[model samples]
Target: MPKPPGKPRPNSRPYTPQRLLSLAVHHEVRRKTQALSAFKDAEDQRPPPEPQLPADAQAQRHEPAAYARRLAMPHEQSWGGISPFAKDYARIVHSSAFRRLQGKTQLIPAGENEVFRTRLTHSLEVADIASRIASTLNHGSGAALGGYRINNDIVACASLLHDLGHPPFGHSGEEVLNERMRDYGGFEGNAQTLRIVTSLESRLGLIEDRAAAEFAIAQAEERPRGMNLTAGTLAAVLKYPYQLGATGRKAGRGAVAGKGIYEEEMPVLHALQALGLGLSPQRRTLECQIMDIADDIAYSAYDLEDTLEAGIVTPLDLVAPDDDLLEAIRSEEGVRACLGPLAGDMHRANTRIVDALTQVFASLFDLGDAYPQIQTDSVEGNRARHIFVARTYLESVMHARHPMVRRQFLEALIERHIAAITLVADADAPHFSRVSVEPGSRLRIECLKAFNYHRVINSRRLKMYHYRSRKILGELFDTLFDNAMERDPKIRGLLLPDRMHEQFRAQGRSQRREAARLVADHLSSLTDSEALRLHAQLTSGQSATFNTYWR
Candidate 1:
């Protein structure tokens, strides 16, 4: 039986910045130690077998069906006539984690305006774009994808689930969580995403149960298996395929700094690699590359639309080159270097799109006068104008008449070259393939990203919200971490939901560290509003009739 909860721990030690940083480092070391112990135990039990694919099998035709092998989950294997990859689609669509994205942030705060994208909407758009890209590659020139057929379903699932680990309050919340977890192996949205899909999510029960049963192990010892998705889909979702901590690979170009799976998740990574499915350990798969590019396109195109609708920026602002802003953008070394040769073409393209969009906006606001007014104050009016701008912009690029269009096409062609999957000719173990992007499009996308980063994300208005979010999250982490270590029943109950609290208590001697991580995970899972409400409750002792907890 578990000990009952009790009062909060004494606040003798103030949570100084230095103290928190020290604590974070301490926890990270502890996590790595525990992980090392586990790794040693697993290694002692059995040496990992060599990958079983034949040398000739390495050269087999790279088709979609061949790569869509399901994991050895009983439920996953029994999906009656449904395509193996399609099960991945269904599993992701029906997941609670995926649904929670609706309440999570995208660019602006969710519910600020119905028209603004939430993580959920962004994910759906990414899925659509990824699928379209895959379909285009599948049918439009097989030579473009290096003779390997693109798997639309795999790409779609990967795209839809890419942002599953983003916490409430967007990147702000993620930053806070990472700081809090610094000692506990550090938190990352992508790494957390892998954890969610493999262990935390309860939808599919334990993936190891099938193996445990074969060994006649007791049911009580079973662990969670996550969604038990197919190997191909899982590979596509791994934007960074390294592990966390010192033992992990160094961050390379296009990879997030120190981003990878948690130490506990190495088994899952190894299991996926062991399937003989031709996945490389170092590089992303071709489908992953497509999903990544689609993500870039959707984010650049749609987030700009959201900014326009919010009136924070305008189509005219993007079109009309502000010399100061242009100089600032070009001053960046990479931008200057990449845009050097393309300057003439980019300028001409920008001029045409801006001029065309200006006319479209004018027509929308033309209330029968020689001159047009910018009628974007009204919600309906703004939405109408946004639609016109988006359509015109998309059409302009699709027609490929503008210089930007030609550059974009050339850039994509270059991406195909870099993203080509090449099987190792003689390696005993399967190695991953490298993915790259053209310098021009990469720089252009960076500039577009910077436009949002500077114009909207760092604008005076949103900074206020971001600052407040940092405070709320910081206080929430401190309060929960303090109480979570207490032996008191009431404090423990308040710190987490019953299920989570029970799990924390069950850790016994390691409850303190486990409690801190559980708190971080719990906080990361909250919606924006939920985080705000809980902060109010914990900080100000405010009482509300509504339930603020989210699973």
Candidate 2:
């Protein structure tokens, strides 16, 4: 009996190593080498390799794998469409864009605390948490998706690659880059992540092969770069399904409203939805839900962890007020203002955050696979109440809401700390601002995000740091470009020092974007100390002079 026309085959085999290797080699030969070098670097540093089966286990490894197996296979079976999820995952994991995250800051500066996380670590944690949530949800005994074959690979890959598009210096860098590129429609990390996965990740022939040459020719007449993934994966990776201006908000909507996929990526996104969601322009899929929940779980807990490790506010600091301070300020107004009276209150507030999270974990674990529909409406209501309740405690007594509190503990500990350290701003800015639950939520989130910017990011220290960094990167680019200018003698060639300059130069007018991208790529790959040192050397200008140890 033949399978129905539209449905996938019941069992499809995983792509053989020979097939995958062939695909990889073909793509490698065609790729711009510099970009491929960065991709290879990332591939080289993937935690540790997953265990491989012995030669005798080939039969077991070759068993048919399905759900979205065709998308993962190196060889094409029928037409052009490959799974979007697979492409997104591969794009994120393999691209230079993802590797640059390691050098980027998260909360504090990259060099601040050894244990404190950078953006790369934070993203990895988020991916892990998201993967767990998706796995539990998919495998859970919930009626929501009982009979469907949930792809674990899709969830894991999507979750891991989600943050690949963040710029340097964490949110601060993101803002500056967005402001700089506003004409390019302003960069959002999430939107950039989408762009990288769908379009920019294919510098090498990783997608183009002898088998795919004809397809590439057709596409070359269109867009040069694309992941060419299945629609299902693309839709799943998209948390916001609408474009920036596509929808009007209904009355009483919350922060979730006005969220949609970016307008620029619509063609690819729409193509993905049409295939995966089985809806034209209107509907979303189950995988999107998993991605969303995973994101939330990761953001809340990971931020808290980063805060703790940085020692900004401790469990003890929140719970206990200073007795000496209270005694010193004895007037009624002074006493009222003193935090000594709020020690117990802070303790309770901290407990609430822990309790709510504990409940979520318990609900996840105890439900033992039957947890997805466990009266989550009521549970979610309770969770929301707790979130507000805990926040209120911080607001009322301990003033734990201050950005300084969190910054103190961050590796980069932005300007919020400098103000506290310098006593420049009233220490209460972090406390005075309530978490806004406004429409678009961007403004409110920006407030928390902005505090970091106004204080630390734009602070003289960080600016100096960036200025120095830009100088070093600029010099490196100059040296490389000068070499190219002198040696290659190309008229009107750009001067960026990337591994792939030759290929970029070959492209002619498209060279500027490629140049900037290369610069971004090189700078993004440096560690904080490495960048600073390099900058120092570049500015020194002499050849290993008295002050000339590698910038």
Candidate 3:
């Protein structure tokens, strides 16, 4: 299917009123006072002192009635779909998925950088940027696309919750978990976020009878509950909506690699389609386009920045011309023969890619009511003109030689190093290999992505850490399972709760696997020091000395 109406040009198009209107209602907010009445009634009808709070903290905050009032009164883009925006807001803000992001790593592990971003902090920044971009477009005053406005709430919520489903240990953790869970459908961070908002987050009884339907949990454990969020928000969250089964691409192909939502969550994914916005399968709405772009912008820029600040990469190394090395390699007749005519294109493509990203950042936040009018009359045409200027500006400064270039450039080098190392003779292997400069277009992009991920992400030190952490996790799981399996009855009581025990006994193998997973989850959630201390105590019989204070 084609895109939704009123598609803004990426990063540079003027914001129209319709875009603003879409932003306003995209998530469809409901008043907590109204929606929670039912949840509250449900809570009150039960006994006192429930383990959960009287109301869901996140849910209560996005009440639709209050949102409606806000829209009715004022804000950007007074459009047709503010309700959907509200729905998205509530689903995201109140969900456990959002909370878990606090624990997930952004650059370093969560514990190492409390002040720096975790995934949650990153998401909030993306949402803020996306909303501002959408708002800028919608704030246009006139008959020109008057009703078109981006729903800021939906954008905010979508951006915030985008990383909600990422497993612990950042990308490395995701890799390990995805490999382990492939049979259940491969794990992708984006897909997990979808699952969490729709299902996994625990929701206790709190709303009233009438309001219950609004926030009713999906009956099936595998399905998405009605975050009761708008279709627009849901659509925007899905950067890739096609499931692995449906995607025609091969298993490890980059496109299909991250394709599907978990099978269990299919029902809720379908429900979002059925009940909320009427988007076609595997397609995104216009609002989703904005959100997705915003995500990319944030991912590329912020992650790069973090890698630099950590003293991992230097910008100077990236920008400095490789003329001497190129000349030396060319003079070596064997190396020259191997490189052939491919060297120039390789350099050019790499340069273009970096230039493209730089341009995106320079122009991204340049628009808005507050910024000065910097208009350009381009003989080449508007979009082309914008893109050229952006690329030029970004290439100039982002790659400019500076004292801290190492901070910036180290990531790319790491990626390149990984790319070079992973190449094996096998074509269909599970692992990726580096490409030489001679690869075709499709293969080249694949190489670039692989190289990028390897250098910046899978550094040796980081991989070593992942290996160590995985070992720690294995030890923790073995300890938990060996001790608790028909041994410590009290611990068994917790693991095999009344409702969970019969199911456990019936599917013994599955139960064992799930028990291991639960233990792994608990282990991954620990801070670095927590994991180390716990491991030491478990092995050496050391006690936590601070327990006396509690006593």
What are the lDDT figures for the candidates, one per model?
0.62, 0.44, 0.47
**CA deviation > 4 Å runs, candidate 3:** 1-84, 87-91, 94-96, 140-146, 204-206, 210-228, 249-255, 276-282, 321-344, 351-452, 473-551
TM-scores of the models, in the order given: 0.68, 0.51, 0.56
Model 1 lDDT tens row, 90-154: 88998888998999889898878876799999999888867766665556545544566566778
Residue 430 C-alpha lDDT in model 2: 15
**Residue 26 lDDT, candidate 1, scale 0-100:** 50
The better-scoring model by TM-score among 2 and 3 is 3
Residue 274 Cα positional deviation in candidate 1, in Å, after optimal superposition: 2.1
Best by TM-score: 1
Q: Which ten residues in a row have the lowest lDDT in candidate 2?
A: 417-426
Predicted candidate 3 versus true structure: per-residue lDDT over 136-216, tens digit per residue: 545531123333334577668778877776656677666665565555455667776666555445432222222122222
Which residues of candidate 2, in runs, are more than 4 Å off?
Answer: 1-75, 78-96, 111-114, 139-141, 203-229, 242-264, 276-284, 317-493, 497-551
How many clashes would you count in candidate 1? 12
